[model samples]
Target: MASPPPPTSSAPTGFSLRKIAIPAFGPSLLFGIGEGAILPIVPLTARDLGASVSMAALMVALISIGSLLNNIPASLITMRWGERWAIVVAGIWSGLGMSLCVLTSHLGLFATGCLMVGMSQAVYNLARQSYMTEAVPITYRARALSTLGGVMRIGMFIGPFLAAAAVHAFGLQAAYVIGIIGVLGAAVVGARIPDLPVPPHPAGQDAPATPTLVSTLRDHRRVFLTIGVGVVLVSAVRASRQAVIPLWAEHLALAPAVASLIYGLAGGIDMLVFYPAGKVMDYKGRRWVAVPSMLIMGVAMLLMPLTTGFATLLMAALAIGFGNGIGSGMIMTLGADHSPRHGRAHFLGVWRLMSDIGSSSGPALLSLLAASLSLALGIAATGLIALVAAAVLASSIPTRRTGAGGAHEK
Candidate 1:
C-alpha cells in the first residue's frame, strides 16, 4: 500500500503547540476533572442509596460499559457534527448525567446517570483524539497526544481533592456538583473554539465518498487483528496495574493510608514521564518507548508477587507507574498512525472499543484468577500478558520513521 500522505497545516512558519493547545486540549482537562471528582464517590453514593456491595460495584462498572457501548455511535456523531461540536454536545450530556445523580435519590435513576456520564465520555474522548490526529503534525503527534493525556491526568489528580473539600463542606451529593461544573465548563470551552476547516481536495479532484464503520473495519481487519490485539494486551496490563497495587498492599497488611501514599507516589512518577516519552517516540520511534514500557511493567508485575513489605511494594508500584507513564500516548498515537484519513473517526471508535474491552476485562481476569486460584498467580498472569504485549508490539509496529517535516518513510 502507498504510504499515507503527510499531514498538512495552514499555520505559518515555526508552528508552536501553544496556538492550538487551549482550543484542542482545554475541554478534555475540564471533562476529566469532573469525571475524576465523581468517580471515587460513585460507589459511596450508591451504597448510601441502599445498593448492595456487588450492585454498587456494578454501578461503577456501568461507566466503562457505557463507554464501550457508545464507541461506534460516538464516532457517527463526531463524523456528522465535527469534533468541536461533538465535544460540546458530549460535555453537556455528561453534565445532565451528573445532574441526575445529584437530584435523584432513586437507585435506578442514579445508575442511569452514571451510564450517561460514561456514554458522554466515549464521545468526548473520541472527539479530542480525532481532532488531534487531524490537527497536529505527525512529527509532533506523539508529543501533542501525550500532552493531552498528561493534561487529563492532572485534572483527575486534582479532582478527588476538590471532591473531598466539597463533600466535607456540604455532603456526599456535593461531589456531583463539581462534576456538573466540570462538564458544563468543558461544553462552554468547546463551543467557543473555532471550528476546523475541512481539508480541501486537490484541484479538479473530487472528495472521496465517506466510508462506513463496517467498511472501515473490514478494510482494516489486518491492522485490528494484529497491532490491535497488541493494543488490547497493553490496555489489559495497564488496567491490572490499578488492581494489583491495592490488592497486594492489602494482602501484605499495609495500612490503608500507607497504601494510598504509595499509590499517589507512583501516580506522581507516572505523570512526570509523559513528555519525555512522547519526545522519544517522535525522535526515535514508537517501539523505543512501547516495547520497553511493556517490558518494565511485565517485570514489575512479576516482581510484585515477591514484595513482602512497604518499601518493596513501593518499588514495584513505582515501576508499574513508570512503565505506564512512558507509554501515555502509545495507543492513541498508534491508532492515528493507522487510521485512514477518509474514515478516521470510525476507525478510532473501533480502536477505542478494543482498548475499553481490555480495560474492562483486565480486572475481571485478575479477580477470577485470585478467587479461583491465588492472588500471586493472577498478578503473574497479567505480567505474562504484558510480556506478550511487548513481543507483539516489537514485531508488529512498522519501522517507518517520521521526519522533522512530518513525512513518514519506511
Candidate 2:
C-alpha cells in the first residue's frame, strides 16, 4: 500500500459518513453489544458459583485486568497483521472466551474466560481506532471517532435488553451465549469487509525501529505525564461512576429493576450527545469538550451522596450520563490526535495500557475508600479527583490542531 499523503489542511473534500460506517461501525457495534451483555452478568454468574460479594467483584475486575495485560500484545498483533486481521482474531477470541464462560462450572475457569473476553476486546478496540487513524480525513476525525463511540454506546444500550430476553427465555448462562453470537456476527462482518490501506514505511529507507513498550513510554513521557495523566484520571472517573452508581442505588434501597431502569435512562442520555460533542471537538477544540464533560461528572459525583431518594439519584445519574455522552470518544480521540502515522500501533498500545490502568484503579480505589471510611466519602473523593483532572487537562492538551493525528505537534 502507498504511504498516506502528509497532513492536508483543506479537509479531504469528499469525506462522508459512509466511508467510515461501512466496515468499522457494524463490527464495533456488535462487539460492544456482546461485551455489554456479558458485563452485568459476570458478577451474578460468580455469585451463583458461591463466591462472596467481594470475590464476585474480583471476578468482574478480571476483565479490565486482562485488557491491561494484553494491550501491548494486542498492539503488536495489529502491527503484524494490520487492523483488519487483528479485528477478525479479536472476534474469534471473544467468542471462545464467551463459550468458556458459558460452559464452565469452575469459578477459576469462568474468570479465565472473562479475562480472555477482555483481552480480545482490547485487541478489537485498538484495531478499529488504528484503522480510523489511517483512513479518515483530518477534519472529520473527531466526528468519526465520536460516532464510533456513539455506535458502541448504542450497542451497549441495547445489549442488556437483549440479555434480559435471552435470560428470561433460558437462564443467566444464556447471556454469555448471546454474547458469543454477537461476537461471531461481528467477526463475520469484519472478515467480509475491505480494510483501509495501511501505509508502508517510506520508500528505500529501512523501517523505523519498532519501539518496545518501555521505550514508547520513555519517548512519550512528557505527554503521558501531563495530558496523558488527565486522560487516565478521566478513565478512572468514568469507571468509578459506573461502580458508584449501582452501589448508590443499592444503598438507597432501590430494587434491582428500578436501579436498572434508572441506569438505563442515564445511558440513554449519554447516547444523545455524541455527535454534538464530536462537532464541537472538530470545530472548537478538544479542551472545550473535555473540560465541561469532566466538570459535569465531578459535580454529579459530589452531589450523588446528597441524594435521598430515587428521584434525586436519577438526577445525578442523568448528569453523569450527560457528562459521559459529551466525552464519548475523548480518550480515543486524544490518542489518535497524538499518534504518528508511523508506528502508531505501538503508541496506541501504550495509550491503551494507561487507560486500562486507570479503569482498574478506579474501582479499586472506590472499594478501598468505601471499606475504610464510607461510600459517600469515597464517592466525594472521586469527584474531587475528577475536578482536579479537568484542571490538569485544561492546562495540558495542545490548544491548536496541527492537522490530523496532530502529526506536526510535539
Candidate 3:
C-alpha cells in the first residue's frame, strides 16, 4: 500500500482541495453521461434492424462478455502502460466502435460494438480507480468512490430521457452517434490528464508477479465464492425485474415512458443515498448494511409485478437501489481491500470478471426460467437466491468497520 496521509479533515475540500479528485472523476462523468445518452435505445435499435427479442437482448449480453474479456487485459495494461494513456485509449476505442455501430444493420455487429464499449469502459475505470486510491487520503477513499456513483446517476438520469427523445425524433442510429460523441469527449478529457508517477519499489530482493491470478484464486477462494454467489444472484434479480417490469406494465396498457421513469428513479436514489450508505459502513458496520440490503432486494423482486404506474414502480426501483447501495458497494470495496500488495490489478480484474459473468448470464437465465414459468415466479426465485447469498456474505465479512471507514487495508 502507498504511505498513509495525515487526517482527512486537515485536507482541503475546496476547489484546490479537489484537484486530484476532479481530474480523476471527470472521465467517469463523461462515460456516465455517454451511458445515459445511449442505453435507452438498445431494444429499439435491435427492433429497427429486424432482430428477435433474444437477439435484441444480445446488446446487453455482449456488453457483459466484453467486460468479462477486458477485465484482466484492462488491469494488465494499466500496470504496464500507466493510467492516463490506457483510459484515453479505451475512450477512443469505444467512441470509434460505437460510431461504426450506426452503419450496421446486423444484430451481431451491433452487439460487437457494445462489447468494445464494455472493454473500453473496463480499462478506463480500472486506470481511473488506481489513480484515485494512490493520490487521495485514505480516509476519503469511499467518499471519492461514492462521488463517481452520484455522477454516473446524474448521467443516467439525463441519458435515458435524451435517448428516448433522440430515438423518438431522429432514430436509434442517431442516438448511438450522440453516445459515440460523448465517449470521444471523455477520451479527449482523459488524454489531457497527466499520468501519476509510480512510487519506487522497496529495496532488496525483487520478484516477478505476486498472487498471479491462479494464486489469488487459491488464497481467496471462500471470499470469492461468497461474493460471486451474491453477484450472480443479484444480477439475475436485476435482469428478471428489468425484463418483466416493462412487459407487465405494457400488459396493463401503461406508457413505456413510465417504465423508463422507474429506472430513472432507481438511479437517482442510488446516487443520492450512497454517501449516507458509506457513512453507515464507516461509523456502524458494513455487514449489517449489506445483509439487510440483500433482503430488501429480494423484497423488491416480490414487489415488481404488483406496480404499474411510474410512482409505484419508483418504489420498487428504490428498493433495488437501496439493496445494491449497501451490498454491492461493500463487496467491491472488500475486493479492493483484500487484494495483496502488488496483486491489486489481478484481483480487481477477477472482481470485474465475476461481475461480467453474472450480468452476462443473468438475463439468459431469467429468459429460460420464465419461458416455462411466470416472470413473477422467476423474480421471486431471484429474491430467494439473494437471501441465501446474503446469509453467506454476512457470515464471511468482519462485523466491525475498518479503514477509511470500511476501506482499510488487510
Best by TM-score, which number?
Answer: 1
Model 1: weakest 10-residue lDDT segment is 2-11
Candidate 2 vs candidate 3, lDDT winner? 2
Question: How far is 391's C-alpha from truth in model 1 (Å)?
Answer: 0.7
Residues 46-146 of candidate 2: C-alpha lDDT, one tens digit per residue:
99988899999888878888889999999899989989889999999999998998898999999899899989989998999998877777677778899
Query: TM-score for each prediction?
Result: 0.96, 0.92, 0.83
- Candidate 3 regions off by >4 Å? 1-17, 49-53, 104-109, 164-171, 203-211, 238-240, 251-255, 303-314, 325-328, 403-410
**Better model by lDDT: candidate 1 vs candidate 2:** 1
Q: How displaced is residue 343 in candidate 3, in Å?
A: 2.2
lDDT of 1: 0.90
Clashing pairs in 2: none
Ten contiguous residues minimizing lDDT sum, candidate 3: 1-10
State the C-alpha lDDT per candidate. 0.90, 0.86, 0.67
| Candidates sorted on lDDT, descending | 1, 2, 3
Give the alpha carbon lDDT tens digit for every residue of 1-410 in model 1: 22345543322367678898888778878988999999999999999999999999989999989999999999999999999899999999999999998898999999999999999999999999998888888878888898889889888998899999999999998999998999899999989878777777899987788799878888899889888999999999998898899999999999999999999999999999999999888777788889999999999999999999999999999999999999998999999888888888999999999999999889999999999999999999999999999999999888755535444436
At residue 105, candidate 2 shows an lDDT of 91
